[model samples]
Target: MTLLPDPIISTWLFSSVVFGPWSNHVTGWWEKKQTHSKLLYLFYEDMVEVNQITTSCAIKMLLELEYSIQVRGRVQFENMKKNSFVNYFTSLAMDFKISPFMRKGKVGDWKNHFTVAQSEQFDEDYKKKMKNITVQFHTVV
Candidate 1:
């Protein structure tokens, strides 16, 4: 499993790649879900549907700030989720570009870019790599 980033930044960073049959990195986290609720599980296609990356990042940033070690014991999750990011980035809006962060957050996106055999190869590898793990694989979309 990959090591999680600093908790402060982790809250603001949403993953755009977490799907079935080919996501050991993602599954590892699922196995430890209770340990890391700050990890926003997002697919590539979701980004395309939303069309806003900065807003997503800002929300994450705010979430992290409110849910870190200093506040988790005192704040209720419902209250934190209710806050919006509409005014969070006004001071730094032009400092960052959104295109690089926006991508085709879609499931099966590989189908359009990978050959049938290549896809099968990935599945084979996935099965082999996950042989000892007990988690069941399921398609999300």
Candidate 2:
């Protein structure tokens, strides 16, 4: 029911064609992980736990990585924002000043942007598209 173009739930379905859509890209890799022994695809929430307000493996990785100056230098966001070398593709895709790359970063923040009608509609579409997805991602919002 939410008509807003950027609502988080629907974005997975209708994001720009340049990258296909998030759902397809994610489930593709999720499905791919079945066949590829070395492929590792983790949800963003799994990577940035503090920022995500959800489960994250990053805190442990960060602590383990503290001794490595090389790893620490590239992982910080402010540094990445300013480092054209790391943000080349992001710069081409988005102007962070106009619409920040990271907003609240909350799990259910999409509900804030959706009207009741929009929410209902999104719920319906989401159900249909995702019914076949067996891999489940859970987050407490």
Quick one: best lDDT, which candidate? 2
Candidate 1 segments whose C-alpha is farther than 4 A from its true place = 1-24, 34-101, 134-140
Writing each residue's lDDT as its tens digit, candidate 2 over 3-110 gives 465465455556765455656776787788799855655554554555433222343443464445554455555655666665344535566567554544456666
Could you estimate the TM-score for every candidate?
A: 0.35, 0.53
**Model 2 residue pairs with clashes:** 1-117, 1-118, 1-121, 1-122, 2-118, 2-119
12 Cα displacement, candidate 2 (Å)? 7.2
Query: Which 10 consecutive positions of candidate 1 have the poorest summed lDDT?
Result: 8-17
- Clashing residue pairs in candidate 1 are 44-105, 44-106, 45-105, 45-106
